[model samples]
Target: MKYLLDTNVCVDYLSGRYPAVTRRLQAAAPDDLRVSSVAVAELRYGAEKSVHKQRNHERLDVFLREVACVDFDRDAASAYGRIRAALEAKGAVVGPYDLQIAGHAVSLGLVLVTGNVREFRRAKRLKVENWRRG
Candidate 1:
């Protein structure tokens, strides 16, 4: 099984801040772990904003080495369109990046691992697991 980790989950795992996500990583196959380009961008965005930019960049480098990055391409755009419409029609609000992450997961047929489950669950047909909630 494969999981497209949300930005928050990616940061949590890379920083070794969450025991649950860390344990989940130890149990899962390294190859089965994946992340989207949007997530990479999100991580970099966070790193740039933090006081310890150099340290964060080092951590991101290590994280990037271990996890494979999947691009946000045409198929993800199509998935975003569908998910956006679905959420709009239902009056559900999600952050733009979260929507993009969800789109990437749906497009790739991978379960989305996120800490913000409430917003992600609003995205119809997108499977979400909260690795941070354990």
Candidate 2:
């Protein structure tokens, strides 16, 4: 199955928080793994502000080389708006970046791989697969 790694999952992988998950991600087929452009932006934001900025930046660069970057197209943008509106109508508020990632995943029909399942759960209309789930 095609899996879109979320920002948190990418962070965990790079930080070595979950070795099993990290290995799983590393061993994933190239065609089955991807990262949203939104996630890349988030990594850059964190890396820029981190105390170990150089290390983080280097890691991010390497990570980018390993996973396919999914860009936000017009369809993804429209999907983001629809997802945001639908979640808001349901009284569930999600972060702007998260919504964009969700939109990209949904638009591309990819299964979202995330550690922050609770945050993603807020978007009832978005299909997500928690990497933490066994």
Candidate 3:
């Protein structure tokens, strides 16, 4: 099964602060892992907003070459609208970025690997695992 990695999980892997995350990722076949367009944008946003000398951006570029970024297509948009509306009706609104990531994961039938479990739980039919826990 393909796994959709959320922004925080991507950050931790890149940061090398968690060997468990890295090991888990390494264990997966490269084709089984993917990052969403939303995550790619977030990574770029974080890199550009940082005061460092483009270190993160350079690393992300290299990383991008290794894994494909799933596009936020029509299916993802439909899922996003449904999820956002449901969450709003339930009074459990989440950030747009997180919603986009979750929507894409759900639409593509990918299990979402994220640290933001609380917020992701707001979306129905979205499978989430917190690699940060291990």
Candidate 4:
């Protein structure tokens, strides 16, 4: 199964906070690992603002090299718009970046691995798996 590692999952793995999930992630086939551009952007944003900026930056680089970075292409962008509209129509206030990530996962047919399941749960169409729960 293709797994799209979410921002929080990546953070937990890098910080060694979730050893079980980290071990599973390490043991998984490299070809099965994926990450959305939104997650990469979030990591970069965190690294830029972190007190240990250099260390976090290095860690993010290594993580990026290990996983395939899925870009937000035309299809994914379209999906994002649809997801946003649908959620808004349902009276949900979904964050822009979260919608983008959800859209990318849906467009790529990837199961999102995240800790913040409730946030992404707003986009019910996107398949999400909480590594912490597993």
- TM-score for each candidate, following the candidate numbering: 0.95, 0.93, 0.95, 0.94
- Flag clash pairs in model 2: none
Rank the candidate models, highest lDDT first.
Answer: 3, 1, 4, 2
Q: Which pairs of residues collide in candidate 1?
A: none
lDDT of each: 0.89, 0.87, 0.90, 0.88
- Model 4 has an lDDT value of 0.88
Residue 2 deviation, candidate 1, in Å? 0.7
Query: Model 3, residue 36: what's the lDDT?
Result: 96
Worst 10 residues of 3 by lDDT: 50-59
Superposed by TM-score, candidate 3 places the C-alpha of residue 104 at a distance from the truth, in angstroms, of 0.5
Query: Where in model 4 is the C-alpha error above 4 Å?
Result: none
Consecutive 10-residue window with the lowest summed lDDT within model 2: 125-134
Candidate 4 TM-score over all chains jointly? 0.94
**Regarding lDDT, does 2 or 3 come out ahead?**
3
Candidate 3 regions exceeding 4 Å error are none
Error of 1 at 101 (Å): 0.6
Give lDDT tens digits, candidate 1, residues 1-134.
89988999887888789999989977898899998999999899999999999999999998888889999999998999889888988888778888988999999999999989888888877999998766
RMSD (CA, angstroms), candidate 4:
1.2
